[model samples]
Every structure is written in C-alpha cells, then in structure tokens.
Target chain A: MSGGTTTRVDARGGSLFAGSASVRALVYVALAALLFGFGAIAPTHLASEFVLRIGAGGLLLGMLALSVAFLMSQAGLVVLGAASVYGGVGYLFAIAMSKWDLSPTAALLFAFCTVIAYAAVLGALIVRTNPLAFMMLTLAAGEMISHSVMLEGLRDYTSGADGLVVTFKGAVFGMTAADFANATQFWPIAWSAAWILGFAAFAVRRSRFGAILRAIQENEERMRFSGFGTYLPRLAAFVFVNAIADVCGLLHVLNSGFVSPESLGLSVSTNALVAALVGGVANSTGPIAGGVLFAFAQDQFGAHGFTQLLTGLAVVVFIVLLPRGVIGGLIEGARRRSVLSSKRRRTA
Target chain B: MRAHGVIALLIANSLALASLLIMLSSGLALIYGLRDVINFGHGALYMLGAYLGYSIALIGGFWTALVVSPLLLALLGIAFEYLVLRPLRGRSHIEVALVTLGLGIILGQALIFVYGGEARGVDAPPALAGSVRMFGLSYPLYRIFLIAMGLGSCTALALWLRFSTSGLYVRAVSQDPSVARMMGVNADRLSLLVTSLSAAFAGVAGVLAGPYLSVDPGMDVTMIVNCLIIVVIGGTGSIAGAIIAALLFGFVQVAGSVFLPDLAALAPYVLLFVVLLIAPRGIGRGRAPA
Candidate 1:
C-alpha cells in the first residue's frame, strides 16, 4: 500500500524530466549553437548596434535570470531580489574602481566577495520563511539597495543618482593587443563565460546536490523528513546563483565601462524575471532562449511606436497562452504528439 | 517649538499620515489577502484614479469627481479582472505579478504619453479651502475633511467585510478556494468582486491624495513601492493589521522626518526589516492558506 501510494503521488506530481531524451538533447544543442552564432556575429552587425548590445546585455540579464531560475526551478524558492545581487555587485565594482581607484582585478574580486556575503546573510535569514514572505523580503532588500544608492551622504562613494563611470583597463587575459586591433575582442570573453557557466549549471543540475535541491523543490517536507538539511541547501542555492549574477555584474561593468542606477533598478529585475519566464523555468536552456527572444523583441519593437505597449502585450499573451514558456510549451506539444502517435500504432 | 504650536503640528501630521497610510494599505491588503495577487499595478490604478479625477474635476467639480472616479475605476478593475487576471489564474503567482508589473510600466508610460509628465495638484474646493483653528494653531480644514473621509471609508469597509454575506464569501474563498467552492461559494466571482472593490478603494485614496500630493507619471513607481512595503509590514489578509501597521508607519515616517530628516526616507525599510525579523508572517495573525 505504501509503495503504490508513492507511485500514485509521483505520477500525479509530474516528473521534471518527463520528455523524451532525444528532444531534450536536441533542444540543448540548438540553444548552444544559437548562443555561439549570436555571440560571433553581434559585434559586426551594422543594421543597428542593438544586436551586439543586446547580445552582451542578454549575457548580463541571463546571468541574473539563471540565478532566479536556480532558486525557482531547482530549489522552489521564488526570489524577487536576484537583481539586487546583480546591481549590488555592479555598485561595488563601480565604487571600488571609481571611488577607491582600485585595479579592475581587485575591484572584481571585492564585488564578488561582497555579493556572496550579502546573499549568504540574506539567504540564511529568509530561507525559512514561506515563499510569499521570501518574495516580499527580497523585494524589500532590493528597494533598500536602490534607495541607499540614492542617499545624499553616499554621493561621495556612490555618486548618488548621477551614477559612477569608470575607465576600463583594456584587457586582463594578455589579449590587450588583439582587443585593440579588433572591436569584438570582448565578445569572446563574454561568450566563453556564458558557455562555461551554462556547462557548470548543467552539471550541477545532474549532481547529487542538484538532486537534493530538486527533491526539495518537489516536496520540502518530505525531504526534511528524509533527514536533509533543507535550510542549508536552499541557502547554498541562493548564494550560488546570486554569485553567478555578481559575475554578470562584473562583466557588465567591464563591458560598458560605466555603472548607473538603471543597472540595479526594478526594471532590470523585472526584465530578468520576464526573460526567465519566457525561456521556461523548468528547462535548463529556457533562460538562454528567453534571454535571446527578449533581447530580440526589445530591439525590434523598441524602435517602433510604444515599446511598453508591445512588451506588455507580449507578456500578457505569454502568461495567458504560454505559461510553461516558449521552449517548455514546444517541448510539451511535441511530447504529446509522440505519445498520441505511439498509442495509435499500438491500437492499430 | 512653542508648546501649543508643537502639539497642533503633531496632531495634524499624525492625522494626515494616518489617513494616507490607511487608505493606501487597506486596498493593498484586501487585494493580496482576498485575491492572492500582489497587484503590482495597484499603484497604477491609484495614479489613474488621480488623473481621471483631475480631468473630471476640471469639468464637473471636485465632489462629483470624487464620487465618479472610483466608480469608473471599479469598472476598469472589473474589466482588468475579466481580461488580464482571470485567464492567468492557477499559474505561478510570480508570473501573474510580473504581468501586472508589465502592465504598470505600460500604463505609466502611456499616461506620460497622453498627459505630459508634469506634476499637477488639484485645488481644494472653495468651501474647504481655508484653515480651521485647532489647539490655538491653524490647520488646513481640507486635510481634516480628507482624514474624516478616509476613516469613514475604512469603517464602512470593515463593517461590510464583517457583516455582509458577500464579504463573508470573499473571506471564505480567500482562506481556501477549493473548500469554499465545495461549500457552494463561487470562488471566481468572489475574486472578481473583491478585486474590483479593492481597486475602487485605491481609487478613493488617490482622489483624497491628489490635493496634498502631486500627481505625475513617475508617481506610480514611488507609490507602488511604498504600498508594497506597507502591505508586507502589515499582515497580508487583515484590515486591522493594515490599520495598525499603517499607523505605525505613518508615525515613524512623520516623526523621523521631523527629527532625523535625512534618515526619514529609510524609516519604512528599517521598519520592514524589523518586521521581517520579528514576524515573517507579518504583524497580524492572518495567515494565507497554502
């Protein structure tokens, strides 16, 4: 009776890895190829500088989205403040580089450490709360960061609302000569970082720690009953994902050579959420797909009439019609078709 | 710093703060507690109410606008529920919240496009324009009237929620939609009604706030962030919780501004952090059912 009940619950709960292996593999490869192609050609695109900008922008947004995706898709934590980590790291880098006159390498290191500390502290505090409260707390934390940046006394260090601008150090990996010669030298670094992070995420998703996180996502109480330290894992996931966002923040400051309040604003946070949702929260490559599509749509419709109207309409439509997200919806449809076809053959 | 003057200032400020917080936070709490939606667009609705009131008052007097704007906003809320929110039900609450955030951005920018982004304030009606002598100090009579209106509305809302069958149905559905449905309550219809009513309350607050606060496109961001903090500090599903939290926030804000003006802006967040530390479930005993 116990075994049967477990199977019944498992069936009703739905497995994350329900789709066929071949389709999943194809989806992953297609995503990898698209990222490579986009990164390669973006800097050269002349119809507008938008493609290249968004390619780089998507990387920054993707990093943040990935952080939230980890919490939402893996650990079942809905973090509304992932953008705070992104913005906080960027703020740290800007303050270090511009205000303190630190070297780029030193600034990057300081920023990463600060974000990790912030995430760990906040994660430990809010991890035990319900999802609703957790979401609100993260939002409050994000607002605090934004407001603190706006405070007048911090103007000397933070530049107040005027923001901070820092000069780039040209190159860090012995690619100075090549970077100066070619305009797209930074593309390789950004693209390589994307691939490495993506691979790391995939591996993590397949690991024992990842399995524990997934189990927690599926049923936190059950995992707790099984003697797992739920709070520690959730906190670890929060810090790890936020650390990834911090890396993106470092890259953003490096690429743009400037940091502004907009980098950490609510819009940046919302865009990351939108991108993750558009990509498919459940799938490993969903954020990549969502990031690309959001960037593309942002570029395409932004130049025309009303950008907010277009984007808002798209979000509303997607939420209503494509709740599983673009990639997830496609995967689901294909799976259903395959199942129906196989059943027909058996009946015949 | 004269004794009577200080007392008057304190009374006026406290009253003003109480009125504003109660008006804003009540709508937020009702929407979240009843509908299970954070309603990120609550501020947009508030802003829309102000603008609509401005236009209507310009043509049809202040009292008329005060009455009509909320009714119109209620219709808009009904339309919003039927159009945007109803379909998105049963999905991730985060997505629903994001969609509303998107709607807010769109509505904000749209308002800017339609009515230039300049800040506007309504002129108080001739009858309530002058000051009333209070505790040997002059205080704006219009503000006192606003306080009365706000408190009256809050009392009416509380009584309705406690006494009426529809209100009981809203409470029941909010507690457990499936159980409420089994108990013969139409959960979807209750959600729609509560959502519209909550938005209508937001509209009333906006109209009351228009004379004292400037209305502009940028106001939505500030307003929404403040309301969200208010709701978070208050428990999500309790009107009494909202009242207590709002009063505390109002006092902290007013007192902080008077004493520590520079840190005054940070007071709400400090309060929020403290509340999170003390009661992660919010201040009141209202617990949203899982």
Candidate 2:
C-alpha cells in the first residue's frame, strides 16, 4: 500500500505503459498504419467498403467510450447522462448546419460552446449532490430534453424524432478537401480525431489538474480543508470531458450521415456506461477496446437481442468479479505480487 | 352539469390511482429502507408478475393467476435475495444499485426473448368484467375490485408489521442491521422476508395492472421510473410514505393528462423537482419504519 512500493511494482510490471500516453500514441500510429495498409492491399470491391464502414463505426463508438472512461476512471465521476451530451450536441450541430444553413465549422463551434454551457450550468447545480441524486437529475434532464425535442412545437427544429440528415462537404485544415463524401473518405478524419483526443486525454491525466482531481476523489474534505476549490475542479473536468463527447457526436453525425432521437435515448446512455465499465474505467485504452467489442457484439446480436443480454451480463460479472475492470484488475494483481516478492526479499 | 357524475368519476379515479400506487411503492420502499439497496429489478419483477398472470389467465383462469402469480413472484424475490443481493451485501449502495440495474436489463431482455417482445393482455374475470353504476355514472367494476384488493393488502401488511414479532425485527434490521444482529435477530432472514413480501406486492400490482395497461417489455422501464419517482418523493423506506407519494403522483399523473395531455409526461418530474428543491429527503424522511 506504500506509494513508492506500488509505483515501483507498477513500473516493473509494465502497468505504466499499459494505459500511458506514449503507449496510446503508439496505438494511434499502429491503427492508422493498419487502416492505410488494408486500404492499399484490399481488392477494390464491396467487401472493403463494408470493412471500412464497420471500422469507422467502431472508431466513433470508441471515441464516445473514451470520453466516458476518462471521466469515470480518472475523476471517479459516473455520468449516466454522458450520451445525452453527445446526442444533444450532435442534434444541435445538425440543426444548425442543415436547417439554419450555418457553416459546418460554425455548427461545430456552437455545439462545443453549448456543451460547455450545459455542463457548467448543470454541473454546478448537481455537483454537490450525492451520486444517486446526480444520476437521477441527469436522467430527468435527458428525458426533458428529449421530450422537448419530440414535442410538436419543436418538430421543425428537431424533426420530432424522425431525425435530421445533414450533408457535410467541408474540409478540416484542407487535408483532402471534402473527404467525408463517403464512409471510407471519412475514416481518416474520425480516426485522427480519436487519436488526437485520446492523446490529449492521456496528457491531461498526467497534469496537475488530474492530480488534484485524483486527490479530490480520494479525500475531498481533506482537499477542501487544504484550500483547494474541489467543486470548481470537478465542474471544469465535467465540462472538459463532455466537450470531448460533443466532438464524438459531431463526428458520429458526419460519418453516419444522419442523427435520431434514439441516439439520445435511455438505452444509448446505458450503453455508454456499460461500454466504459466493461472496458475498464481505470484507463483510456480499456474503453477503446471495450467500444470495439461492444459495437461488434451489437451488430452480431442485433437480430436476436443477444447483444443486450450479453452486455448486461458482462456488466454484472465485471462489477461483481472484476471490480477494478479487466485491465485494472490485471495490472493491480501483477503489482500486488511484485510488491509481495519484494517484501519477501527484504525480509530475507 | 351533473355534480354527482363528476363526484363519482373523481372518486373512481382516486381509488384506482391509490390502489395502483400502493401496490407499486410498497416493495420499493421496503428494499430501499431495509437493505439500503434500491432494487432496480423491482420493475422486472412487476413485469414478471404481469406475464405470469397473463399466462395463467390464458391457460387456467384469471383468478388462479391472481393467487398463483404473487406467490411465484414472492419466491422469485427470495431467490433474487439469496443469489444476487446477498453476495453483494456490504458493497457500496451505489455499486449494488448499478448491479441491480444490470440485473434489470438482463431480466428485461430475457423477458423479451421469452415473450417475443409483443404486448399481452389479460381479461378481467366475469364478475369484475363489466362497469357498475354509481352516483349516476358507470365505473369499471374491475377498477373497483383492484382498489378493494389494494386496500385490503395494505391493511394486512400494516397489521402484520405492527402486531407481529418478525415485523419488529424487520423494522429493527432496517434501522441498523448490525445492532439488530447483536440483539440476536437474524438480519438476513428478515431481509429475505421483506424482499419476498415486496416482490409479492409488485406481483399483485402486476396482476391488477395487466388488464389496464399493456404487458410488454417496455413496461419494466416505465414502471421502474414512475415507482422511483414516487419512492424518492414520498420518502425512501416508509410504507406510509410510499402510499402517500404514490397517491399524490397518481393523482397528478391522471389529472395532469386530463387537463394537458401534451405536458402530462413532464408533470411528475416537475413535481419531483419542486419537492426536491423544498425537501430533498422527501416528504416523510424521518418517518421511515425505523
């Protein structure tokens, strides 16, 4: 339990690199290389298109999962309403771009600003409440927003649950103009965004704010006593992390070619939570792995409803048996044995 | 306009709402107050009860299901306690909450797989099938029967908890399980009993509800959300609180829909938010069965 001993053991067992920034940067490079390699070698046929579509979808879900995992693992915030933030911002982006003829860049900027506004206002109100209260409030907020959108009055804006489709012919930094013309064309942008976000999250976890958040999670009262503004750090983290979720939503709409009320539904929120928990909320990579697994299972079991049942079972099993999540549990176990052997050596 | 007709409709609706609310909130209140575990699976249990009733009514008779379904569900509740909740006894309440949430999802999806995700219904028995005239207005006799059954069950439960030795132990365990155990009361047994009783109540509610509402996979989500709102507003763990909260919510829901159908869905949350702002602990906090 000594901090030094734990750190030494973690270092020795490769736990440091297991979810570390450098490792994730390497993962990003590897994924991009693999995708490019596959695109290069695959026969120009329908099968490659299918593979690319699924891969892109997996990457989008992974990005969403990564945002949630960062908040849950790094900050100990179980945000059941994370998907609403994602879907809400996406909806806003689509409406702004398609209905009002706002430029895609303006829409994306508006969506991010809206998410920050939402997080600050709602986070400040519910941040002091207990976890259950916060969760219920978030659920209520999500329901209210969805219902509002679905109402006849807002139908013109939200399309009243029928959903809205937007055409994106914009370029980011002129990196191949209008590349999102098709799913295959859109893959590079989505993957690059995921890589950049994942890298930034990894960097954040190493920063002073991350340390303070960890301290607050461990002993908030003590940290408050030491003159730190606990609430502000948590609110900032909430805003920051949810902004990333909004970006995922933006990419999701751009890649999927449409958005629907189902995206903001309770099931979607529950799915995000499940993915984050199953993948190991203790690290960013866990969600990436978890997201891909979840999306694949979803497609495979879509016909029979087996995927939902399996996901629920996995969540229960992971929580009950693997309390620290898959990766965290393995790393912790290795660290523990290493500490034990080192102690035995010192005793001898 | 006929005053008597208006009065009759109001009475009938009030009675129906009260009956439904009591049935839904009792078990929720018990598990929450006693075990400090919010059984998110309560809704699934409710759905199970309805499905059980539907099948029994279809095969044997409606009355047979009215009797058999609750008993079966009570046993299921006991099994749930021993299997899932017991093992996770000392974990954080939130962890238990999440696990039960997972269990709810599994149970709900499994029910869908078994029942084919279609809506099912049960017919009221012959005696309770038709409407009865009261104060110059006709009201469904089945609704009246439901009201009577709900009231009778509440009375029986209240009496048992007040007069029985085991009732005292349940109350003690709810207040502080460790102290109750120190005093030689079997906390685990009492927990199982309460959980079973709660599930049984939900089953009875399901049987009554099946005729009024469509029995479908979606029912679990709707019932759980409504019941959680009631339990949270009325007070967590207090049977009296549950009854009061449920009645209040039932009236608001029914009346709100009658007045403004469009805004009806938002009524409960609006009420919940107002109450939370004024009294976050709910209306009957300190009055929980402790």
Candidate 3:
C-alpha cells in the first residue's frame, strides 16, 4: 500500500525531471557565449566610461542575484541573508589586503576558504527549517554580520562606519591594481566570472543532485521514502550558493577598493533578491538580466531623489503585476502563443 | 551612578520598550493567526503612525494624535488589504512574505520622500512632562505611562481573546480557517478586520513612541526587525507568548547596551538563534500545525 502511494507521488516529479538534456546544454552554451560577447565588446561600444563602469558593477551584483536565482529555482529556498556572505567575504578580503598587507591573489584565496567554512556552519544551522523560518534566520544572519562589522572594539581592523580603504599590492593576472580597477580591463574579468558561474548554475540544474533537489521541492516526504537523505542536498546547495555570493563580494571589493558595513546591510540583500525576482528566478538568465536593469535603474534614479522610494515601488509592482518577473512573463507569452498555434494546426 | 540606581533605571527603560514591543508583536501575532500573512509593512505602519502623530500633535495635542493616528492607519490597512494583500490569496507563504516585504519597502521609502530625511520627535504632554519618584530613584512620568499602557492593553487583549464574541470568532479562524469557513464564519472579513486591528496597534505604538523616539525613514526597518524577532521568539499566532518574548528581548537590548555596548545590537539576534536552535517550531506552547 505504501509502495503504491510512493509511486503515485514519484510520478509528480519528486525523483525525476523530464527536461531534454540536449536542449538544456545548447541553451547553457548560448547563454555563456552571449555573456562573454557582451563583456568583450561592452567597454568599446557602451556609451561613456560611466555606463561601462555601471555594467561591471552590475555583473558583480548579477552574480549575487544569480546565486539567489540558483537557490530558489534549484532547491526551493529563498535566502534573505545572502548579504551576510557577500559582505563577510568582502570584509575578509579588505582586512587581509590592508591590515595584513597580503597580495591580491593571496587575499582572494584566503577569503574564499574562510567563506566556505563560514557557509558550511551557517548552512547546517538553517537547512532544517521551513521557508518562513529560513527567511528569518538568513535575515538574522545578515544583521549579525552587519552588527559585528560595526562594533567599536573592531574599529581598528574593520574601520567601523568610516570604512576601510585598501591598496592592492602585486598583480592580479599580470595586471596592476590600478589596471584591474580600470573599467575596460575589469569588464573581461567580471564577464568571465559571470559566464563561468552561469554555466556552473546550468550544470548544477542538470545534475543528479539538482534532480534530487527539484524532487525535494516537489515532495519532501516522497523523496525521504525513496531513501534520499534530503538535508545533505539542501545544505550542500546552500553552501554552494554562499560560495558564489562570496566570489561576488571579493570581486566587488577589488573593483571598489574599499569595504564598509553598508555592504552587509539589508539593502544589499534586498537589491539582489529583488533583482532575482524581477529577472525571474526560474532560470539562469533572469538574475543577470535583472541585475543589469537594477544597476541601470539605480544609476539613473539614484541621482534625482528618493532612489529607495522608486526601487521599493518597482519591487511591489513587479510582485503584484508580474510575479514571474520579466523573463517569466516573456516565456509565458511565448508558451501561450505556441499553444494557440498548435491548437489551430490541429483544428485545420 | 550608584549600582542600585543604575539597575532601577535599566528596568524602567526595558519596561518602556517592552510596552512598545507588546503592542507591535501582539498585533503581528493576531494578523499571522488569521491571515497567515506576516506583515513586513508593520514597521512602515508604525513609522507612519509616528509621523501622523507628530503632525496631529502640532495642531491638536498628544492625546489627540494618539487617538487619531491609529484610526487613520486602520484606513490604510483596509486599503492595503483590499488592494495589495487580497491578490496574494492561495499563493505560497514565501510569495505572500515577499509581497509584504515589497510593500514595506514602498511604504517606508514613500514616507522618507514625503517627510524628507530628518528625524522628527513629538513633545510629551504638558501634564506628564516631569519626572516622578519610583523605587529608589526618580523616573520619567512618560516612561511610567508607557509601562502602564503596555500592561493595560496586554491585559485587555488577553481578556478579550478569552471572553469576547468577536475575539472567539478570531480564535476560531486562527485555529483553522477551512473549519471556520465550514462553520459559516467569514474568513475574508475577519482577515481584513484583523489586519486593520494589527495596523492600529502598530500605529498606537508609533504615536506613543513619538514623545521619546525620533521618527525617521530608517525607523521602519528597525521596528520591523524588532517586532519580527519578538513574534518569532514568542511563536507565531500566540499573543501571550509575544508579551513574554517582548519583555525578555526588552531587557536583553537595554541591558546589553549597558554592559556590552559594542555587542548590544547582536544580543537579540543571538537570542533568536539560540531559541530557534532549541525549538525549531518556536519558544511558545501555542505551536501552529506546520
């Protein structure tokens, strides 16, 4: 009797995903190529140095948003504490470079290792909860990071609210700190990171682990009965996403050459999550698209007045009118058109 | 300061904060019980109440602002329920939470735009402007009033929930909406009513807070986080639990600031982490069925 019930649930996609492998591979390659092409030509073709700089900045945020999209679409988790990982990594990078006078490459490597350890611990704490609890825990985690960064005793190292300024020593991939800071020089690096990360996201989505996660999302109980240990996959996904956020934070600090408590604040997390939602969290491309749009919007609207006001309204409008986000809406329209055409062909 | 006097002062301060938190979290619990919607915009409502009270106090008096601000917020709550929240019915809990999060952002920023970025404060009523003797030390009359009001409303709410007909209806809907619907109870209307009442409580908190705390754009986020911590610690949908959690947090915050000034902001978060670790469901006995 239990076996019958389990099979019925299994058919609902808990243990298997039915997407065509070849089609997914093609789409992933095309996405990587598009991002690579955009990065290579953006500096030369994009109007002014300002917009190119914004594009580079957008790519960093896009990475964070992509991580958001990854966790949401792959594992059915919405993380509100991504800023903790992002900002925490950035602070580590800054402290290593400025306080310890470490080389840029060494700092990046150290920060990456530390972040992996950090996320592993945090992931273990939060992976067992429901969505609501997960959200609050992540939020609490972000606040904890922010508060720790701003503590008075830590002022010597973190620089507290004044922010820590770093001058990178040695070269990053044969380029000086100044050269790397150049928008034209930085675009390729940022682009490469995005492309690689995007491909990684795609690969994970098509992996067996990804299939199990999707299954867990569909029905946790069914997966458990199937003898799949659910918590490990969920925790692994959380750690992986945090690792991605950490990379983004590392790049962000390198580009800006400073780190502050604001990097860990709720606004940073909110922007990334909003970008994921706006771009559509269902696929890899949505977050990248959303991040660029948000960066541009912030660039334009931030100057006038009440930037937050506009951004806030934008998020609400998106949620109410277009819950699936921009990419989701387009995909839906295409699907509907295809359905209608198929119906007409059948009728004929 | 003498150690005894300092302890007494901290107690009074924590008591004052406990009152504000009780009002905020109880309302949040009530709405969560009925609507299953965690109003992230609860903070925005509180901020709006403070701002409106400030304006009303300029023309009328502190008492008038206290009375009128929450009434005005109840109207906003109704419109919010009708427009923004109603569309989110039958969606996943995360989606509702996201929409409310968005709503909070909109409302908080809109206030910032309208009022500008400066912090505004309201004067205490003339009658209670001075300090009064309490314990071994003198305490602000306004602080004592806050403590009294906090205790008063908490008792009133507890009694009503236990005794009143509408409160019974609220309890019924909170326990199980589908069953309540089968029993001919109007879930939608009760949700709307509960949302408005929740908003009203936040407004009352805002107005009461205006005499001491500065009204600013940033206050919304701070208020939301505090109330969320209280609600989570108390367990969702449990009013009495909210009160206990509020007092616990109030003392932690004030006492933390005094003793471990650098880590004061982290005290509540640590508490939240420990509580969740101990009871994944929540700290309260009133556990909602997952």
lDDT of 3 by residue, A213-273 (tens): 9999888889999999999999999988998898898888778877788888898888898
Q: Which pairs of residues have clashing backbones in candidate 3?
A: none
Candidate 1, position A293, lDDT: 78
The TM-score of candidate 1 is: 0.88
Identify the candidate with maximal DockQ: 3
Arranged by lDDT with the best first, the candidates are: 3, 2, 1
How many collisions between residues are there in candidate 1? 0
| Model 2 CA deviation exceeding 4 Å by range | A1-47, A74-77, A168-178, A203-216, A219-234, A333-348, B1-15, B286-290
Model number with the top lDDT: 3
Interface RMSD values for all candidates: 2.3, 3.1, 1.8
**How far in Å is the alpha carbon of A215 misplaced in model 2?**
4.4
Residue range with the least summed lDDT across 10 consecutive positions in model 3 chain A:
A8-17
- Per-residue lDDT for B41-109 in model 3, tens only? 788899999999999999999999999999999999899889867877867767777778877888888
- The digit string of per-residue lDDT tens for model 2 on B1-290 reads 38766656766686687787788778777777667777777888889889989988998888999899999999998988999889998777667777888898898888898889779877888989999887667789998898898788888878888889998887777677668889999877888898888898888888888887779888887788788778777766667877888788877777777677777777787887777777766787523222
* Per-residue accuracy of model 1 over A186-279 as CA lDDT, tens digit each: 5556666776677777788889999999998778889989999888988888888887788777777667766677777776777777777787
The CA-based lDDT of model 2 is what?
0.76
Q: In model 1, where do residues sit more than 4 Å from their true spots?
A: A1-50, A168-183, A334-348, B3-11, B174-182
User: How far out, in Å, is residue A130 in model 2?
Assistant: 2.3
DockQ of 1: 0.41
